[model samples]
Target: MSPTIFYGQTGKFTFRMLATVLGGQSICILLGALVARAIAATDQGSGSSTAYLVVGVGLGALCIVAAGLMRRPWGVTLGWVVQALTLLSALVVPMMFVVGLFFLALWVTCLVKGAKVDAEMARREAAAGGSEAGADDDGTADRVDG
Candidate 1:
């Protein structure tokens, strides 16, 4: 796939990576809720199960929208909102705090590293383009016998 469409502008690699991560988080949350319902300790009732399902589905939807929006400037802000919601989920499942924190760290790292990679790629592309332009301007192209 074209990098511009899949990953957004040259300097926004972090946004693309963040979108993928959010999608993953959505699936995990849905699966975890179902698993928790299966476990005896957490088998509350149909009412609780429904609640879990609703939250999971809502989160999944949000992740999908956020992923698609990553190309926009507001995408990062939406990502932060998703992160906060994930952290807030700990109120329902205490263990989620740990999981949420881990993902939070991963999110931060992806943003930092992805931004650096984007910058490096942009720099290389600019250098290459400049060199090609100079060669054409200097009559290097015409000098080639072929």
Candidate 2:
């Protein structure tokens, strides 16, 4: 059996990593929400705290789906949406403002660096292709000894 290769553009990898981070963050948010609910229970109730749970879980699921959708053109757009939602989460959990900012920085870095890496990879592939074509036309092997 042949081993499957998962090679692709660097941007995809970056987005996948972002998705993973978002999913993990979602779980953290859920835990925080539960704690918030317990605290609020002594005073008010779970009514407001439930919003955090719902939004947290929902964002987590969205991130997972967005990761899969990275192959599509709209995948990046979805990522932006996730970022916005993550920032908006600060409204509920004040600490999320800090966490969200950190993630936002990471997301931006990924996009910028991913594009650079992808461009370099494409350039290298094109050069390799050109070299291969020249060798074939000259009836020579494309490898060198020593």
User: For each candidate, what is the lDDT?
Assistant: 0.71, 0.66
The lDDT of model 1 is 0.71
Model 1 regions lying over 4 Å from their true place: 1-10, 36-46, 134-143
lDDT of 2: 0.66
lDDT for residue 87 in candidate 1, whole number 0-100: 84
Model 1 lDDT, residue 114, Cα: 80
Give the alpha carbon lDDT tens digit for every residue of 1-146 in model 1: 33222223425667778888888887766766665445534555444666676776787688788878878867767777877888887777677677778778777777778877887988988988877854676537546576
lDDT string, candidate 2, 46-113, tens digits: 56655656667777677777767766667767777877887787776678788778877777766766
Q: Please give the lDDT score at residue 125 for candidate 2.
A: 78
